[model samples]
Target: MARDDRAVGVSSFEGQATSAGQASLAGEATGTASASGPHFAAGPPAETGEPLRHPPHGEGDERAGEVSAGGRGRPSRAPPSLSWLLFSRLVFPGIFLASGLAGLLTLREIVAPPLDMPRILSGLERGGSARAEALTQVHEAILDPRYRDLKADPELAESLIRVLETELRQPITGSPEFTVAYRAQLCRLVRELDTPRTVPVLLIAVECRIADTPQLDSPIRRAAAEGVVTALERHGPDCVRSVPGGVAALCRAAKDPVAPVRAAAAAALGHIGGDEVCDLLREMLHDDTDVVRYNAAIALAYAGRGTGLDTLHEFLRSENVRNLADTGSTESVIGDRTCKLLCRALFALDRLCDRSTEERLAVLHPAMEDLCLSRAPEEVRTLAMRVDLKIERFHR
Candidate 1:
């Protein structure tokens, strides 16, 4: 008799239904699968005379292969080969990587600007369609380290200005936005290349007019004048500032009917003097626009002509500067102009007076010193302090 074992072998005899009997039966049989093999299960033989039998348990013998703890048979599944394992792991990741690379390559084309700087600039030099917009792209290229030679060359700068002028002189045929773009590029070119050659173009730009267009509708004429003034306003290299003709151009521009242009020209002339500029300044003093006359007086005084001494003198000691500290404004434009006059007056007085004007300047220094000691507008106060420093230095 034998007892059931692992709940997998049912007892075949009534006498083999106990746990102890099962252990005892398993211990008794050493060979059951073989004719002489062990019967490790805890169960009784079903037949009375035949030898006790058990199911065959071998690696792939389906008759009685691997079995569950509950005595149920199970199927064997083969493992994948090493080569197949490697292929499956890599193939999916490889597909994803290729997709990402393709996407990046496509995106780069959409995002990156044209990289061939020389080609872009060449087209700009030739004044291709809508060149102003092209320059906005090439601006970074011009500053790129690879384009050092172009940036260093004065001739290249001059050539760009020439092309810019040609474009400005042409008729506006496209969108007004395009016209604006052309104007913007022109300003950028002037500012970037403050070379002396640009001065002439700037001067020409000031008076540039389109034949049939009304004054308000005239893009070229308006942009040209603005561009000239902008160029003059820049603190650029002496190569541009020291060029001789700029003085004459500025002297003429000072007489321009446009007050802003005239004011810009006056300021430039004061900065860069000429034997003729003083007379121009003297003439500007009579102009109807107060701003032009005011700037001219300051320019002349700074140039050591002493011609504006009375104007500047009145400016330094005037009650207007004193009044500015208390009020928001008087007549707003007049009050604004008054502050500007004082600021320029102080700057002019800071300049060294010529031998011819020394006596006049010396007499006014005491009154100027008192005004410097008083409270005033920040710009005026700053300029006044600078003037005081110059006077202190002069007396020493």
Candidate 2:
């Protein structure tokens, strides 16, 4: 998945090479083949069958009436022509060999080696599409075992975070969409690094607002918030709390005007246990956006707070959630997101139910039973049944 995304991200570079290189190669091959092809090489001149005659310099000039041994005046066959030999043995083979090598090299350029990390990090600091391209390579590198330890590179992670901060403040000089995408991708990289040092910067990114462009601001902030969630998951909330203003930053982001940013903040807060975080998440339960509310509920459950039980009950009844499980298409982005959110909710509920009183477990019974018996997708039904079993065990 990362590789496919990186391919798309760097498609501009590949598209340019494809047009120029492949077109030139096509023309070159056509010109060479046509020049040597039978159509271009004229056939021998037609035989008139007349004796060859020339002005006789003298009466006995033997060259005056020259003819072939058959007396048909045909030119005697001679050794193969030099041009033919070169075209047949050298040029023809050379054309194919050159074409093969050219094609191989073109493919090599399109699928170039992963740029070295230092070079990639340098390009990222340079900004613009170079930064976008560099981020793509870094994403691919993270998946590569050779660069898997990238998460541990404290210096590199800090440098990238600084670049991210500087780039976010700069005016949009290129396609705004491209700018937003790279900024989001940069946040994703910080998330991948799983370094606690980036917690402070990630917090700053979540609240950093781009002027007059909610379209741009929302995605970047959402990505930054997700980065915070990833850090908490890896190193725990203590790492974030240690950073001055980190928890406060998240609290502010939980109320971001953008629903996705709010949703991401709820997810991050779920990993932390505290009255403040729970209060914030509980407040978020009333958010207008369905995803925001759902995320807030799931987060509260993660903190072992049952304040989100009603929200989870509501989530189980949502038409969108029910349909998401039944959809046959695997590529639907909404479907994937819904599935993940549903899975998280079920897992959170299952854990939460384990600690609930018998009466509390009874509150969840109807939703769990209905989900298990319904035509929800197999995975959803399976998880719902697990929740039922957990509830049943308490009764037993």
Model 1 alpha-carbon drift over 4 Å, by segment: 1-116, 126-130, 138-156, 174-181, 211-248, 313-346, 354-356, 362-383, 392-396
Looking at model 1, residue 35 earns an lDDT score of: 36
Clashes of 2: 0
C-alpha lDDT (0 to 100) for residue 197 of candidate 2: 85
lDDT of 2 by residue, 1-396 (tens): 999999987997788777766656665656532443222222333564566575666653343235354475655356999999989999999999999999998776566465477877788778767877877777777766656667787767877888888977887666877777767877887878857888887888888776467756688899999888888878998988898888888899888888898999999988876998898899999999999999999998878888888888888788777676455343578777877788888988877877556356567788888777766667877888998998888777
Instruction: Compute the lDDT for candidate 2.
Output: 0.79
Span of ten consecutive residues with least summed lDDT in model 1 = 30-39
* Every candidate's lDDT: 0.62, 0.79
Per-residue C-alpha lDDT of model 1 across residues 130-243, encoded as one tens digit per residue? 465557655765665554455545755765776767766787676755664566456555545544566667666655544343443344434454455445546542533565
